[model samples]
Target: MKTTLQRIGMILFMTGFVFSVCAQEMEVTGTVYDAHDKSPLVGVTVQVKGTQNGTVTDVNGRYRIKVEKGNTLSFSYIGYLVQEIKVNKLHLDVYLKPDKVALEEVVVVAFGTQKKNAVAGSVMRVADQSYYLPSVIFPYPREVNTEEYEAFKENRFLSTIQHPLSTFSLDVDGASYSNIRRMINQGQMPSKDVVRVEEIVNYFSYDYPQPSDGYPVRIVTETAVCPWNKKHNMVHIGVKAKEIPSETLPVSNFVFLLDVSGSMFSANKLPLVKASMKLLVNNLRPKDQVAIVTYAGAAGEVLPSTSASDKQKIMEALDNLQAGGSTAGGAGIQLAYKIAEKNLVKGGNNRVILCTDGDFNVGVSSLTELESLIESKRKSGVFLTVLGYGMGNYKDNKLQTLAQKGNGNHAYIDNLQEANKVLVNEFGGTMYAVAKDVKLQVEFNPNFVNAYRLIGYESRLLNDEDFNDDTKDAGELGAGHTVTALYEIVPVGVDVPVGNVDKLKYQQTKNDVSLPKFADSKELLTVKLRYKEPDKDVSRKLEVPVLANRMNLNASQDFNFAMAAAMFGQLLRNSDFKGDAEYSDVIRLARKGLGNDPNGYRHEFIRLVEAVEQLEK
Candidate 1:
């Protein structure tokens, strides 16, 4: 981390307002400025929520808009943060702060197939503390083939009696699996960091029943003998997000936040983004509104918010984009969110679809600043979907941070087919939020099991207390999405699962105060889930207790295939708990679970296992 951030600031100059309410409407007026130095900010946009009425701030950082008393007013500016206020009979003044991640004076070369002129402006890079400019100009640069990932250790087995509670956020991200598949297809061995087992397991949907109850997500579980570790018991836990029909889903407000940086000048980057976004655009209902924001040298709104019925306007905006300039992700993010907030949808699905390689080389380019900005903006009720493109030079770490911090999920679009799978086939799940901050906590009964290990989800683990904390952020579940987790349990009487740790010395014994209660409970474990409604702040909780039934010789088809995917993950990562796990066994389990194979995703999983087998050979 740097010692001090260069307090790049923004300011709002406020003049008092009269109760001047005529027919419940008033002329809302305000000015935006640079907070650090009080310099007037030009081109700031002030808009009334849920309406097309808006105006831009002049060079004096002043603007006025007439809106209703209860309407929300959005103040937005490039390279700065956004401020929103509801109209009341009070003083009208807001001091906007700087988006530290604001893009500086960055430049990029715009090259065509034929020779093109070099960019003229000097590109800026950040230095710690006080600033000094030693201008360095270089020619067209060579592409850097590098990628970043979130590093996490595998979950380990814990004694049921010692640590009876297991808690983690339920995640539906499938980026890791498709990303690994891309590497395998290209004959590259996916490193450990590149493999997230939960994502791999969640790449395919299971036939988990939807919520029949009033809740938005339903929890289902099936018990089966562990495929890799035979003596161990495996439990497949599935949480299915309620599916809202296309017509039933709230009208959407979308902002396409695209990265057109120099790094994105590849076949799989900007071009692919345009194509992928078109698929989503075609799926939007006529009532939905779409806007385009692109960031490179500086962030700008390429297309104003237009109704989806005008498909040609939206399509042309995406088609006209060309990749260039240094990454100004901060500016782009703020602008996109600003647009989404300006066109706020009451009880509707509002989202920002960010297409990027996640590389930010210039313009307030610190990850911490970007994260802080995103966390603050999520309160506006707009969801986020991060579509990562390109391979080498990919910043998965940044994508992960932006998505998890916001009400969002991340997906890597390596090819057009994967793009179709995410944006088209699963449009409902990809674009609509059925539930947010969904978390699961499991309590293992000492009487039913000796020890248990949760497969994958190392990054999504929450503190045991977080399950009940409404303020804690968890995973966001989209409409019709299913999040599955597997736990390998060692029944009380069975030999300790392979790679066993020493018996947990909980310090208390059979005569201890807690021991008698463990012996009294007949249930195996209880799965509790907590989630917040899309429009509410309070959380709702649901739980289902499983009895200590014997392990089944036959399991649900979905359970079988999910376990197969889990086994494949263990083998690929060479997990410590992978007892007797082999590629052949993974293939067999996958084959058994290929019930209907609706989308042939199971077949793809089997092929991935074979690819890994060949790699090992």
Candidate 2:
């Protein structure tokens, strides 16, 4: 028996050796490129066709991987056609064509307008202009669709291709706008994720630093006649952050509105949320207060508001929380807000920091209802901030609306680093609102420019009359955060839409310049801002004039950065007026304008753009 066993082992060993020798390792190296422009593609996936072995292209669109020589290498990415090639060559350059007509052609630009065919470029020296939380991506198996479940059982399915209809709710409120309403009503939801509400809402930093203009702290405003209802006025406000401050700020009242539903049970869902929250807790100052609110099949305040000063207590509350059951987010929200209201410290920052996967199915399930609820609650002076977590079944649209109406900031915490960025480094600014109900409106002189479109912020646009209505809520300014807005202006000669009124011969045109000679050209755009100190009821207005000189798109860092960001957003949204914008063109423009690399956020933008290009190939 021993001899036979030894003979069998030797035979098996030799067979393994023979197979190993026969299957030589294939060294696959390649450069990913944009099929449309023949540009290099970064972050494109290069995988062994059938196996899990895969690698992504670097910033320069270069990738190297080792696979069995006979295995085929599959090159795949979103927004681009997939390509498969046998591992026969050591060097390969794969060109991915952009799916021009693919629903992926949309961009979430200024004001969250998901326009298709918008042309814009990537900003240079910037971090990811847009990023979805990791939880939103790797959803749990239980959250998988019927088809996906079948594939899971097979245990051989490739990436689960996201359909437009499957994640339709993740985009901007489909029922909010007329066009989207039309599409949704017809049951023809686009399959591509063009304008994700979370990305659009999180794109701009809010205006912070109460009394500073050097940075983007100050909010800018202007008044105009409302197009929808001429009887009412339209108030346009721009939120700007003054400067990134260096201070150990005030105490905080934080109620964590977490979702521990069955959807978040996956390793990347609930587990990641727990780990991420710990990172945030570790950064809290002793003066700050923390509370835990968990919701699943039922809602409960697992930890009453505790002082950040009590580290052990806070940590234990967080540690004790677990995930299970369905989501009763509405109930949890009510409870969390109640806790916040109860622990409301006058003058001290009172905020309910909602941490969730954003999948609210039970209790006030409708987005509008949720938004209306938040709107009423903000009047309590307890601000709301949303920290998103988990993936599959994520409801970004709902959370975005909730935060917007709640008069707070929205952040997608995809990684621990981002958590630190929001919770630790910018703790004061993130938790405390120096200015509330911030609004901006800019009235441009018809002479300086033919036409202009405010990039992004489509959803935040206010009615002209809303400017003076203190009751009309807007955005809140955090401490030392910068808010950027871009205006694509057509020079005087451009055939831009001059007002849509009748061309009356009596209405003075070029001749009016002489009549209003006293009017300074510098005041071409009048910027008005309204805000109430965090604790005050009566709002105050601040006025600034945007001189024609400040319109130097090439000279000012503010102009350059704003333009770059706007262009990038427009490109993503596929705006109708994103004129002649190209990825490489925008990259060049931004590289020149990005004056410094203090935060390395700018550099990250460049990498992300390159990554997107690769993905689009």
Instruction: Name the best candidate (by lDDT).
Output: 1
Extract clashing residue pairs from model 1: 10-35, 11-35, 146-393
**Alpha-carbon RMSD, candidate 2:** 14.4
Cα distance off (Å), candidate 1, residue 65: 43
**Tens digits of lDDT, candidate 2, 1-617:** 99999999999999999899669786777788998888887445566754545555644577767888668887765457678887766788899876554434444232232334343332111111322222111212433211000000100111111100000001111111212211221112322232432233234343222546333345553443322222322223345544434345566778888888877664445544565566567777777788888999888888877877787887667656667798888898899889999988777778887877677778887888898889888988789888765333455567667877887776665444455566766666677777777776656665454455554455566667777788887777676655544444444554543334454586664434445543446445666667777887787777776655443212344344444554555555555545566667556656755666565656656555554554344
Ten-residue stretch with the least lDDT total in model 2: 147-156
lDDT of each: 0.78, 0.57
Task: List, residue by residue over 88-112, the lDDT tens digit for candidate 1.
Answer: 8534655667754322222222211
State every prediction's TM-score relative to the real structure: 0.75, 0.64
Q: Candidate 2: lDDT of 339?
A: 91
The stretch of ten residues in a row with the least summed lDDT in candidate 1 is 122-131
Q: How many Å off is the CA of 594 in candidate 2?
A: 3.5
Candidate 1 Cα deviation (angstroms), residue 523: 0.9
User: Distance from true position, residue 382, model 2, in Å?
Assistant: 0.8
Best by TM-score: 1
